[model samples]
Target chain A: MILLLACVLWCVAFRCHEWLQSRNRTTFPMPVRAVWLNQGVRALAPCLALALCLMHSPALGVLFWLGLGSVCGVCTSVLMAVLKNKRGRAPAGKPPL
Target chain B: MRDTLRVHMGWLHSWLGFLAGLLLLCIFASGTLAVFDTEITHWMQPEVPLHTRTALTPAALNAAAQAVEASERQGFSTFLSLPSHRDPVLRVLHYDGYEFTGPALSPETGTSFAPRETAGGQFFYNFHFSLRGGDHPGVQLVTFLGLCLLVTLGSGLVIHLKALWPDLVLLRPFGPRPRAWVDAHLIAGVLFLPFILFMAYTGTAIHARVLLPAQSFFSPSPAGPPKKSAPKGRLLQAGPPLPPLAPLITQGRERLHSPDGNLVLFTADDVRIFRSDASGPFLTRDHADFSRKDGHFLRSVTRSSPTVATMQLVRGLHYARYAPLTLRWLYFLSGLAATALAGSGLVVFLMKRRRSSGENAFFRLAEALTLTVITGFPIATLGLFWANRCLPVALTGRIMAEIDLFFTLWTLFAIHALLLCLRRHAAAAWRQHLYCLALAGGMLPLVDLLSGSHPWGDGAMLFVTVDALAFLSGLIALFAAQHLRRPAT
Candidate 1:
């Protein structure tokens, strides 16, 4: 769950407009403070997740976090691609489905 | 200069990746399956009652010891494995050249029951490391392949460094076939980089002794005592009775500072109690030895030296015996991702060359070999399971028969692929193989439901899980086959 949140925060901080647009949502250009806040949270969420995992058990916790984090990141990316293609909204330069 | 370097690196990545990727696919796939070897073994032996959480009784241990002694009398060097959460039966096992095989004793009754002989998942475990070719040649080859994988990964990174992060999450499954394959190769390779790197490095390091033998710094002096010769044959002799194992286990656990003792190895003179691999992430063979005749504690051996401990840690990470259920599943997924990365790289290589090399005999053979390695292996694996169900349980040489069937199926698939490629119908071969995989995988659950031993019994969940995964694989193969029906963009 924490990893999922981290992925979401990352997508938002990176301004994944294609994903957002496909979901009938929009995130207009943010103010400087908002942009920084989004980026900060995006970076911090993974660290927080790591901390929580480490609190469980130091060695195995690190391994678990890395493996789970990789899977979640890929799943998030695949989800974005699927959503964008579903709505027939390929990015400007990329080929359409 | 940068363009030239990138081009050179790309050449290295493509050729080496194609050459080594085939064997690496087998290694990764088998290693992934080996992660669940115990569960698969359990599933294979349906005669064994499920949920048999009977406590490890002293009688059971003694019974297992007796079994070990008997096997020794018959010229087999064996050890006793104590019951654990994963396998709740005392097992007396010996290396049968390919895997450990022996009788399993009931924890409650201290009596033996026959579980039909099959290679079980240990086949995968053995194939993962040795390719079932034994220590000298097979391990050496695998270690070499591991080095090749490392080099290929490095060159690949060099070729893609500029776009690494920018395209980290980019995948276009609906794009042109070659583009989709490249995207898949990149995404899987990048996302699972840590896992594949760790596995490759640790796996190679574990077998360093085979690849780079250590030299002795000091030679034996003429003054040194003569080396003792190995004992003469006493296959029929029983030297000593084993001391009661329960107390020794407790003492060994205390000595090792571990909560559980998992293995007891017996010799003519002494018994050694080993700490369970499940006890921690460091798979130390921390064992406490005791005199067999008197049950007196002799000495405790722990790999406390920095070098040995580091090696143990490396082995532990690769083996992952200490991983919990969830973490193990994570390992499984990561391993599959790594396999996909290799498979996609192979496909991309083929697709990129197809137009230019379509008429080349060697290129056609390469396509055939790729089909055999990627799809043929899974087909054989599924066929092995099916054979396990179909073969009569009481037949002699049943284990050999099952193994032979697995190889036969693989060989037949390779032949089929070769023939089709010779006829210049390699694409049809792909679709046909995928359809076969789909049929086999899709019907696996149904076959189990019909012929499985007590499918709805105590261990129903394990059966269900295996069936579901097979069914899911079948569905994916079906999807891939359907995708192949469309013309190439």
Candidate 2:
């Protein structure tokens, strides 16, 4: 239980730092916001999966957590890619006539 | 100087990676091996016979320790470790007063065993942290290197951010020098940055605990009054000699519940401490439990502990103690990637310099470091393993001597690289360096066999493993060297 809490705390601390750094930047896109939300959910997923495993079976919980973490990594990568591509595709600000 | 988070972090990553890249390479590579330290130890001690017994009883182990203690005056404060079924020897470790620290195993009767110096296991351990030097000298130097790595990793992160999203998933194997370095660094760092960060923080934390204890949040325990470095005169009337260690063996076997636990005896007038552990759910070699230092058969906690469970947990996590096989391998591969990242980062600096400085003094210095560090440390490490296999048992101060051989050869390699780099065909000199590395690595195993060390022996696995690894890594170096042609003037 303590370990789970510790992990949560560590993730929050790291995310908080990132958020603070990004606060003054241009407003984040909707996908980036969704990605951030998913990261928050993902942070607690390990502990939740572990609890579920204890309530159910260890094998199930472990597989679930692994899947969860892998998905989170993949999703974050994808979101970052999409946001970058969207920015690249938008027309540049018009030059003075 | 950009205010953007990505820009700053990218900058931080580059500088940190650049500075600490080489040393971190050694740390991660050597640390990956440290995961198998005990297995390697077993492979190194060919003389110890494997045990047939599946389990050991604590009482029997204590009894054996008692018996051994009755005859020997100095080895009494020993821990009786239950033998693994895979190997048939009972291990007794005496640390209080011995020329060196090691296990004495009873292969036949499971009673008294002789002491011998084993440096191969320790070499890997030290090499991970200190490069075979003592804590103060070696670890301090490495930590300084680690600080540099921290800076490099930070800066590298910043530089990668501009194209990070587009290039993050890219794993281009063939590219120009900078492109390759960037890809290698980004892929490895992004994939394993969490691992590297944790490792760095924990490593620095551990070093701080040892070298800068004043910085520790928890102060040392005040219970056991600090003793003088050298013991003073005779308020210390020694106790009566311990009874035959055979009885303690019986005691340990009963308590430990395994038949394989061997008693290591220490003889003295006083202070007989018997330690043993149980076999059920025995911790794997990678689990870094403090209590396990006494082996599974010994569960008794000491009175004055310095570090807390939280501290231990962080340390264990950093060491990948609880990682399963798949994760362990993943960690190992990530470590190797980090090493390549570091090595390539250093090479990037050199490759960039060749164009800017050409044949000037500035270029020459960069070229020298590239040769010396890029090749020096690995050669020194391989040489140390070779010494462990070939050195005679009777050699005095063998451990220290083995370390000395590592430095001596490393220095020579550095000088050789320096001289070679200055030759007319500097590029060809690299090819030749790779050739020498391959030759030396190839001959190591043959040298071991010639010196009477058998690779297949029960305790001789490290000699073979290290030898094989050297040869394999050398082959990679050979391949890399072939790809390099003279830079277009």
Identify the leading candidate in terms of TM-score: 1
DockQ for candidate 2: 0.05
TM-scores, all candidates, are 0.92, 0.66
For each candidate, report what fraction of the true interface contacts it reproduces.
Answer: 0.37, 0.01
Candidate 2 structure lDDT:
0.54
lDDT of 1 by residue, B1-489 (tens): 989999999999999999999899999999999999998888888877767778877888778878877888787668888888878888888877788898888988889877888789899999999887788799999999999999999999999999786676777776666777788889889878999999999999999788887765465556878886433332335558777888998888788876643888877788988999988878898899999899999998885899889998999999998888878998999999988998998988888888799899999999999999899999999998898888999889888898999999999999999999989999999999999999999999998888956648778899999989999999999999998898876
Give the Å shift of residue B191 in candidate 1. 0.6
Q: Model 2, residue B395: displacement in angstroms? A: 4.0
Worst 10 residues of 1 chain A by lDDT: A18-27
Compute the lDDT of residue B306 as modeled in candidate 1: 90
